[model samples]
Target chain A: MDALTPHLPVLLVLTPLFGGLLAALMPRRGPAPWIWSALVTGFEVLLGLSMVKLVRQSPQETITYFIGWWPAEYGIAYEIDALNAYVILVVALLAFVSTIYAKSSVEDEIPKDRHNFFYSIWLLAISGMVGICATADTFNIYVLLEISSLTVYTLIAMGKYRDRRALTASLKYLILGSIGATFILLGIGYLLMLTGTLNMADMHEQLMLMKAEGDLAGNRTILVGFTFITVGLGLKMAMWPLHLWLPNAYTFAPSAVSALVASTATKVGVYMAFRFIFTLFGSVYDSSATLALMAFCGTLGIIVSSIRAAQATNVKKILAYSSVGQLGYIVVGFSMANESGVAASVIHILNHAVTKGAMFMACGAVVLRMGNADLKSFYGLGRRMPATMAAFTIGGLGLIGMPLTSGFISKFYLISGALHDGKWWLAMVVLAGSLISIIYVWRVLEVIYFKKPEKRAPVEEAPFTMLIAMWILASASVILGVDAELTGRLAEFAARVLIGGAT
Target chain B: MEGLGLFNYWIAVAIMMVGFYGVIAKRNLVKQAISLGLFQTGVFLFYITMSVYRAPDGTPGRAPVWEAILDGFTKDPGPYDNPLPHVLMLTAIVVGVSTLSVALAIIMNIKRLYGTVEADEISEIEEAIEHREEMMSR
Candidate 1:
């Protein structure tokens, strides 16, 4: 209702762009860029929250923000409905919280000279993520996806200062990421060939008409386009099989990159995949054959990655593999194609973000203290770094989908949805994944609490700032689990919107 | 296939697969990067191929420009091709150039660190580093 509503879309994007440039230009000062990033995230989070409120309150439950006052059908616009509003807010919240946590971790991990540039790249990554989530234009998403991905490669490569392997890891990421982006672009081109439009809503209407007219060739083109987009985005999101580049990327990248990218980057890819499959290509991809394919891949990703995690020795690799498996849950939700299934996917997005963000940040705290995050290195840390360990443990419990955490809430909905859809085996597969994940979580717990420290182990808790940030997310995971009503309701609404097809 | 003149698309797919195979199948760092470039060119070719539109008599159109849309031009230029794909490719080409440069720069950095750009050699060095660390931890 306020004057800000119209400008909210472009402002959401531009604020971070200008903030990043400002942060990059700050005088040689430590933490100045950090403070700047914190402020930018704070402002963006408020904007995102208010945008979500405005969209939900609107009769149409969608906010169409046209850039430069162009008509909605012709110009670039940010389409925020129940689905992306939830994702954008979650991403902004994590970006803001992790920026606070990045201060101490970056100081210890990165060279002091790179801190300002690091903060700038971090802000750029956030802005790019916001752009990808907000844009209604399909071509624009590919451009923004490249924007965020390019910045992330640099952010991860910054880890080379501490561990040289980060160079190769980031190189692998760069090569793989380029391929993914190209595939996505190719997919967009295919759609343009069919509908001659890039605006998602317009394209949907065009596709509907094509289907109604019994356009077999058009449908065939769409199916090919859908495959290209899915494969490209699946690579980007680290889908189970094409996930060769993930473990090393996570383990060797700076801890802050691990947390931020783990929470937001892949989630954006997941969101795009969800939008393309359920919204843009709705009904077409929601059929039994496609859902069956997704269910198979999703379950396989879950079982395989969980097994890999249980066998891994490095803590970051374990968490990284765990993330791939967690993403599979979201994929499975979409595979169900029902209201509850889509809602569960939405709910799991937020839950996994909260829990994984906390866990990785805690790992960063450990790395900051001891300079390594090997499982063997966790011995006796529960006593020395009590607060950091507790945060990690609480988050680990959440990862295990234990009660009193957001993980429990997500799993409950996901399983119920699977059962309701008569895919009882999928529910069992999910439970089996949970059972496998417990072993890996327990591996960390046993090392941290049960084993005795070597004579030379360091004795110190993480800096208070890092612990504070970790607790913020770790506690939120608990609170969200205890009362899943809000996430549940919002996710249900988002799901209903998705399953009801684009309005 | 005979009526559609699909050979252009077939060639584009062939080039794309070759480039994709090089990227995934080759082990040399520079080879992989070059293959990435090749693969993008394949995509570029696809877009270019898709952009080609023939008149009713099978004549390619001119580039869309000021003369094509003025409504009072001396020579009546018939329907222009869809310039959208052309514009989209302009952006894609720019992105591909940037990606290639960044990838090459990373390869340079890797060579400086381990004195080798071969993927296997680099992994060998990495394994040596990991092996040493394992002993130290033990």
Candidate 2:
């Protein structure tokens, strides 16, 4: 059992993959696929929790599993450290909740005939994301990224019911996303050509040896590879100029799809960027210029997205723009390259996932009942579905960084880190963006609670499964906000692991 | 500089430039798709060019696989065509095809709804419609 514990990371990814294939083949019975997905995801969450516990107990240890029992020198390997373990837990929890929420939400949003297919794709996407987080090999990351992205395109395209624009948005995403993946693949090829290895640990060891011997050829090639990889991953994470596809895709996708992807997809991309920047190149490169460029772009994204959010009329689009701004904050946090800065960003990965997931899921409930996600459609929603509206209100407060909510913890750490770095201007921009967030969030609140109902349209509360899931994440947002020590330690440990420390 | 020829890489770069130009300048969506294809093909060509190996006697080196099999696998495999770039490009081509197919499908849908496939025309029409709606509301 002690030996088996090290293999739990690989099982966390494989279980969902195999389950997705099996569930896809199952006959389209009544909610069977959804049930199967939930069961599989539940098991995954258990596995993730066990891994987290294992990490806490032995923070200094690294778990390496070789595929097919082949030697690590030649075969593929899965490496799990404290950093990826945290990511795995986040991905699994969001996937599980989204699956449970999708049970009724998908029924109302998607056609009946397509429900099983949607669940299957959702499982596949989760599996792919988990695989990307778990793998220690660069080539394996690219393959897993493709798997996740292809499934995402299909899932976003499934939003044809809401608007035909989803089809176009999905297509644009496919084009840009493929370009990004291809660039990453090319970059990986460049690395393999120079190093003659695909395993990240071996590559690191070899790179250090080469550096000691003053091997400029390999070093230069690796630098070029790093540049390509950074640009490629940047496009996927929606870092400014390349973020053209994000707003439309989020706005037009189905409510549940939007919620799931918003919570997890870009977060995973940011994680990949962090992994590359801090892990593979951390020791070799003085990336202050790179970090500065990222900071500049992130600040621009925050400003642009904040203004866009305020100007937008569609509730989902406003939230979508806000997501971009929130992601900008995460980017800037990491760019500071300080321990507290990276930790705050890492913690926000979880905080933002739950907060945004709750908010989007609440919006899904509103869309299900109202047939639209426009701000006007939410007039007096507080009186009708008090539970869901309350969750939305809480999520809004969290977005604006109110006290006793998850957003406050994230913003406080980010601001403190910026101040520590003496980036007072960046800190001011962060606060300014927060101020703009207040306007849009208040707009939603005013329509939902303060304004009068449009007419006597029959409305009902969100179903049990959805409300349960929303409350789960919403409560977590508040609980984590009040108790910051647990997430803070995990984030610090993750940063250390990424920077080549044992813990 | 003594023996290596840079012409192959230059040709690949030219092809890539043409493709990029097409993607930026083409009016039809399908033309843009073709342009993307061309650009990817150029990249593949560039990778192949970079991996070329020459024998000591001045002949082109064969792929390493045959030499490994024929020499009882004892000798270091002769410098061969780099299989790594080829493998990577193969995956890249598939990704390009997937993206192209999805792009074309979207173009078809856009045509079905908007009655045109020109990007500028579609934008113009949308702008005109938005303007009329704004004026009427005022």
The CA lDDT of each predicted structure is: 0.87, 0.84
What's the i-RMS for candidate 1 in angstroms? 1.3
Which candidate's DockQ is highest? 1
A379-437: candidate 2 lDDT, tens digit per residue:
89999999999989889999999999999998998999999989899899999989999
The residue ranges of model 1 lying beyond 4 angstroms of the native Cα positions read A217-219, A284-287, A456-458, B1-4, B69-76, B134-138
Sliding window of 10 residues with minimal summed lDDT for model 2 chain A: A494-503
Candidate 2 Cα deviation (angstroms), residue B111: 4.2
For candidate 1, lDDT tens digit of each residue in A264-348? 9999988998788878888544346666787788899999999999987789989999998998998898888888888888898
Across B5-85, the per-residue lDDT of candidate 1 in tens digits comes to: 988888888899999999999999999999999999999889888888889897777776766557566677776777878
What are the DockQ scores of the candidates, in order? 0.66, 0.35
